[model samples]
Target: MGVMNELINRQNVETLAQVLGEAAPGSSWGHVAGAAAELDGLSLRARTDRISTALLADIRLMPEPGFPTAARTFRTALGSAGFTGWIIWPVSETAVTLALETGAGPDPAGDFDDCLALLAELTPRLTGEFAIRRLLDRDLERSLRVIQGWTGHPDEHVRRLASEGTRPYLPWAVRVPGIVLAPEATIPLLDALYRDPSDYVRRSVANHLNDVARNAPALVVATAERWLAAPDGNTAPVVRHGLRTLIKNAHPGALLLLGFVPASLAVTGPRLDRKSVALPGELAFDFEISNTGAADARLAVDYVVHYMKANGTTSAKVFKIGALTLAAGETRSVTKRHAFRQMTTRVHHAGVHALELQINGIRHGHTEFQVQV
Candidate 1:
């Protein structure tokens, strides 16, 4: 795949200029065209912001130059041969900038509501999730009240945006502290959207619930419990995904909700193939578990890697293994290989690292190994 910065490159900026210039013939789009060279060395999000800033200058040249005028100009360009793809990211952002910079009228509420409508209209092309943060931070209640209404919208993209845009910990999006402070504010939207007909919308609801779990574990559990109580065929997976973080942390409620109850099991060694591993290497391990109880047991088996951080502290991350039902008096062995390679998301430290097995919220068989990076 191409790097993220390529999403908003010189070609995209030039295309945006042509579309916007055609939509409003009188306005000069040279400001946007000039921003192409400035995108070099910048990250994806930075390029988006730079293009939006350039578009703002050109938007001011339009007649009555404001958010309403800019929204109409942009709407006019939405056709078969109009601007689309990543270029629309900056266009939507420019709309947000103009709305926030210049109020619609004396009534701020009117401007707020209208800006939201514009975003909803633009979201079908490219997400307005990131740009919606500015409004959420400005007045979360106002923005949410509008977004809540979006849950029932016919379009799946709008429905997904209703949940994704308001996530407390939305990735690559601006932080909305109000959502974190009041985690319950977005729960109703999740409640309305968790059973959406579209898988795309349902996934966003699951992610939104997961984001809420970061701050309010109890609240997330409660919400998930409600979902489970009145579940459809797809509800289980959604709850599992939504509660993944809590499950990794061994939250009792999350464990129980997923039916991974504590069980008596005779566990054997998580024997490592090698005690020491070199850089860009793999470590093979195997573990055996027998259900010692009178009844069968459901297992949520996972492997934990306590990675040594730069500060000499270890951070634990859980990697999932498949779940299975263990019959009474039956033993099963599982063998897996873990690769310790260089990755942008994870940095390997040359020191002692630890591995352990976790089943149904219970940890077992701690093992230490040396990593040479």
Candidate 2:
């Protein structure tokens, strides 16, 4: 065996346990050890299902930045230990490793769409959702092409990734740069999968379109209008998920496209008086909205406070306005009382910070205030 392979074989669970215990001082390894031990304890004849749960948890604790190397070592150990059923030679992982080892950007894997094919095949088999997500995040072209292809895949899982992987601001995963940069690309891909036969696939389509809506609202608004007009059973719900917030906030043409079906009424845009509230301070605003439509609406409005740090990056934190479902033609006035507790861990510098209110889906109220810490 090569030296690297030998090294990987040597880095077994026992060694892994010790390194993880000390990998970062005062770092909590927690059940990470137990998870690794469970993998070590698996027998050669162990079913693929046997080691999956433990491996999934254990890999989460695995650090990034050379994570690709550690994964290779993991593969070597698995092979030498005769545990092949669980071995994953992922397009994302292989792509990462290949890039790292060669000190080059990823080359095109089989045709323009090969990466997609591999990722679709591998997403289900892999242990960690985030790792594959990171892989997709790293290779958007390949990932999307593959996902688009999978919209036609016979496997339901592949079809789901087409929608699931492209979510904007998908939690616990890196945001796909391409989708963020050029969200327009996601439209056609979503259209193909919106009516997928699988409910699993349909749910992903809803969430995916919602993801797009969050970042690029108009793109979603326009596409949703087209789908809503079609009135197809498949794309309507998918389009609705994408348009719900826009319709609630009265984004110009959204309601018109929904046949002005008068989707539940909503009130939005609270007016707050002050630019800056002093620490140990409370900010108060009066929020008012009237629903004149026929349908009863479930209304939700919230505040996003943006804190300007010394580094010039704004940190956005969301505060909720409790849920209220509006009755038809009813107008309600509500109060939002926001208390600013000085964050001790991070200090504020003197600067103008931005804050906005999101009602249903539209960002209506805006406050840019100057503050000194």
Candidate 3:
């Protein structure tokens, strides 16, 4: 089995049940074990859902009301699981999440404050990113206040949650409509974390900014420019990564900001090692660049391969080879080999393939080769 499948198997669930039973002597393990066994045939996500449902059924059996007491009870039970690192953390967090979800309902028997507090405690352990989404929808202003406070928290994880949880375009998480409609609302939080001491936090901040850049490119560019104006050794990575998508799209403003300008450049000797190839073959090529301009040229050298699809149409995929600076009359040579090995993600088709060189977003020379089954 794959690593993920092994991690969430029945054995892990039983281990969780055992830990919970140990944590709370009176807690019933038989029911938890029985429910977990039912998850044997389910897929990863389905198993998680089944486990949550099973835990909810068992929590209902406990005498304590849903809110603070029962939730706290579960959190306390997790303590006995020992610090097994991230492997088992999600399993524990899933149980806790079910408890919080059950307790925060309209007829919740638990205290709202207690649920929020438990979420805060769980933030560092397994990330309250998913749980916080519901809270944001319930009360945007209030959730923003809570998240803003977390930005200054001592834990780097909590601080990252503050930015990540509020991302307008957080992947696998529901969109925060308020942030989508008014991205400026997230800027204050981003500002607090743009130069965060933790690379972990700054990376999240960069992704958040990049998400914003999708709908508001100018805003992100302006923010990057401002940050770059007073370049800090730490913030440079964030800025560079945050602008990656834009740079790939060949945004004029982004290229200018990064100093990748167009120059009088020429590419020659675009040759493929094989004029025809089959599956499990390799395509190798070499090319040389000539800087015919008077001034020095900074070039972002890349290549694109136009792969033929089953429908006989073609799609161009770009790959970065290297970068260089060439003084007047300087010449440099680069070579690369790409594998035509079958991939689960891409199916290879037989047809004429086109190859080209791209410098500073401009395509220079072209060559063609053929591929067979």
Candidate 4:
């Protein structure tokens, strides 16, 4: 199992039951205890769902059990010191699930609003990001309208949840189609948050914009441009991260916004140290670039690897090689080493692979090498 999946193992399940058992005495926590036994083969998210299902079943055993009642029980644990860590993931999930299940409890609108508030409060425990997506999926505008206020929240965690939760492609969280369909909806929130004091919150804002850049490059560039016009000391990094996807795709506006404009350059071989590499080996290469034009060139140097896939096709992925400027009639040499190994994120396939250099938004040198299985 992946290390991340192990985060919600038997110990975490038992800890969750112990904490909840303390909050609600007399209720059978056997349902939650069984979650530990059921967790073996499940993925991280599946384990969360399994635990949440158990939590819901245990909560249902209480008299007059409903959204408000369950929320109160959760709140009791929230006040307890043990109500933190990975355990909160299932707790957050349970809160939202119960809220949706019992729509017209004591106060209908307030139930939904309370759930949003509960997530913001719960975020400091672990993260309410994943739970908030279901709320967003239920009512995008209402959720955004409520979350919009979170941008200025005093807690950095709450502020980050504001951006991270609304992200159209938030990793591991269910997609909120409304955010994808109406990409502009979250722009205001990003605008409010790009200059946030906390790096944690600003990073989430950058990722949110990066998600929007997938389909709306122009909007992202325009937003980045505006931020550049009135940039704070940290704005550049935020804009750069936000436009990373567009930058990788060689989007002109994104490059220009980051000062990596078109440039005239004399390029040399991305001379390979070896023409072939073995599995679990390393390949080294060096290259040189000279400013051929009379003007200084600001460059975003990158390298691309055309990796051979299991399907006998090559897929190219870009990797950064650091940025530099070449003055008129100046030249610079660069060397880099790359390792090929099996990883959970990427698998190595033995075949002919290609490497290319990218300067500014243009591709320069191409070299082919072989990988032996």
Candidate 5:
């Protein structure tokens, strides 16, 4: 089974049912078991929703009246499941989502605080990011305060949440308007996690900074410069990954920071294996470069393909080929193959496409190819 399948399988729901049974013996495990049986016929998302719905009903059957009490009850039940660390994350995620969807009352702020605290203890398990995003929509300032405090938490998971939860362009989660509009607010939390002792937390911090870099390159460049000046072993990787987007975009400041100097290099013989190819085919090409300059040069070589769209327009997609250093009077040859496979996120249209080689962010050579259906 795939990872997603393994995560929300029949067995997981059964385990959850057992835990709930252990938590509140008076509750109906038969109902929970019946719900788990229905999951095998549904998709992953449907399974999650069904499980949450089933768990909520079971919790209601317990003595608890409010969501806060129910969330605590679920967490306590989860502890008895014999699953250590993050293996039980999905269960916690489902419990938290159930709390958020069905538990909010007149005191939303108070309810949100309770949920946030519960998430901290149970480990958000990848669900806290979106949950926090929703909370941000309800109360930006208050939610930010809660998230900011998480940055200093003793638990690395909570500290990671401080950055991950506030990412402006977090994938699969609703965007936080405040952070999207003014990302500078998140700088303090990013700074706190910049040199985090845990690699997991550092990765989240780096990704958060990368999201910030998309909107504010100058800010990221400045931050990278500062971090690099007094860098430790762990901090170095964070800065490098944080600047990945800018570096891939060939931002001048990013290249300079990474020691890749922009220099006029000679590119020759961009030879294609064939001038034309059909959809779902491969395009192979080779190119050579020479360092005509008098000094050693570090170069980032990338290729941009201007794909033809259905509307008779073209969209450019950049692909990184290779990065190398050439001594003065040295030459090198590189070859690459690009597959025009159909992608769900992209539609392929038959038309003449333009390919170009970029050296140190400068377009150096150009070629054309035809893609047919």
Candidate 6:
């Protein structure tokens, strides 16, 4: 990798950029030989040199817009350069970005430790399936140590990067590496970022927690329940997203939190709106339920909110208020609050959105209304 430094020098960027400028998108190949030569020149200087600086220089200096062509160039250059490990792993971002975008997949050029080392280098600059795959490739126990340490990086981008980059089944990103399939492995990482001060970061935290919700609802429910039972602003949404599917399944605890019981459950009307509320301000939804159960059952109703971004699609999240145990056969009146206030992270929108309330494990028999933003 040291031999490759020659190509990474300031002079190489100028040459590579000039080559790319002179050649049209599909015609950049003419420069590959020259660039590869420049890299090889550097490799000769060191016995350990596998990649030439020229190749790295070419990669870093590759033209941006011709995404596909540049991707091929990087892949070929990396293979030719004999990329051993992360000593050059800072280039993982460049390579992975191209590989991921080109749909070429990973080559795993180096040995096992190289994989972990690569993650340690690139996880901050690159994330999503890119990070997850590499992290999984590394020793699970050791990789986790790296991830745990990353949560505290002074740079919040890296911190937020830690969570968003690890989402299993992250679309437009790679899928989970086979080993850490279960959500348990991801818990500490999620827990650490749950209360991030940045809503941008928190939203990633919610999505990731929800990803966990898909696999281990029971555990996530406990996580959410823990936060619900206690009172913490930052953890509420995370807990809710983690518990959403469970709430829909009418988990006893989830139902209890959403407000459902034998008595006091009101003759509430359905939520009939298109499910969109505007953001940049605050949103509040108030509902009353009358419990009509004969025996004493806890009332817990959980709500799932689908938010429409300006882009014309929707993203979802879950929110929990509290749990109430209804008195046997008594008609208890319960009120639930849903807030979409500014500064709380999950913002609303001006497009079509939908909200669903799961009562006793089913969409309430009534219609749900769409609220104005």
The best candidate in terms of TM-score: 1
Each prediction's number of clashing residue pairs: 0, 1, 1, 0, 0, 44
**Which residue pairs overlap in candidate 4's backbone?**
none
lDDT at 67, model 2: 35
lDDT at position 67, candidate 3: 45
1-373, model 6: which lDDT tens digit per residue?
4544543443433344344444434444333345444443344223112223333345445455322444444334433323323323324443433333333333423333333344444443333235346545444675567667778877676677677767765654546654336678877887777777878777787777667766676776676665566656777666656555666566666545544533435546433333444443333444555556566766555666676676867776655555656665554443444555544365555555556565555555333334455
TM-score of structure candidate 3:
0.83
Residues 181-264 of candidate 2 have per-residue lDDT tens digits of 888887877788776788777877777777777667787878776766665677776776666665555565655555443344
In model 2, the Cα lDDT at residue 52 comes to 35
lDDT per prediction? 0.88, 0.57, 0.74, 0.89, 0.76, 0.52
Off by over 4 Å in 3: 29-31, 38-42, 81-117, 137-141, 167-183
The sequence of per-residue lDDT tens digits that candidate 3 reaches over residues 1-373 is 3555444667767766777677667877566577656765555556656665566566667676454445666577657644233323344444345534643444542444444556666766566676567667656786686678877889998899888888888875767787888877788898888888899999999999888887888898898898888767888789878887777667788778877898887789678898998988988999999999999998877788899999999998888775689999999988899889788778889999988888878887788899988
Task: Estimate TM-scores for all models.
Answer: 0.96, 0.49, 0.83, 0.96, 0.88, 0.48
Candidate 5: 10-residue stretch with minimal lDDT: 81-90
Task: Please provide, for model 4 over 1-373, each residue's C-alpha lDDT reduced to its tens digit, 9 standing for 90 to 100.
Answer: 5787888889878878888788888767889998898887788889899999999888888886778877887888887877788878999999898887755387877889899999988999899999999889998888889999999899999999999999999988889888899999999999999999999999999999999999899999999999989889999999989988888889999998899988889999799999999988999999999999999999998899999999999999999887899999999999999999889899889899999998887997889999988
Q: List per-candidate RMSD values in Å.
A: 1.5, 11.6, 3.4, 1.6, 2.9, 13.3
Model 5 off-target regions past 4 Å?
1-6, 29-31, 82-108, 124-127
1-373, model 1: which lDDT tens digit per residue? Answer: 2498898898878888888778877778988999987988888888888998888888777668777788788888886365777877888888777777755546556767888888888889888898899999988888888999999999998999999999999998989989989999999999999999999999999999999998999999999999989999899999999999888889999999888998989999799999999989999999999999999999888999889898999989999987879998989999999999989899999898999999998999999999999
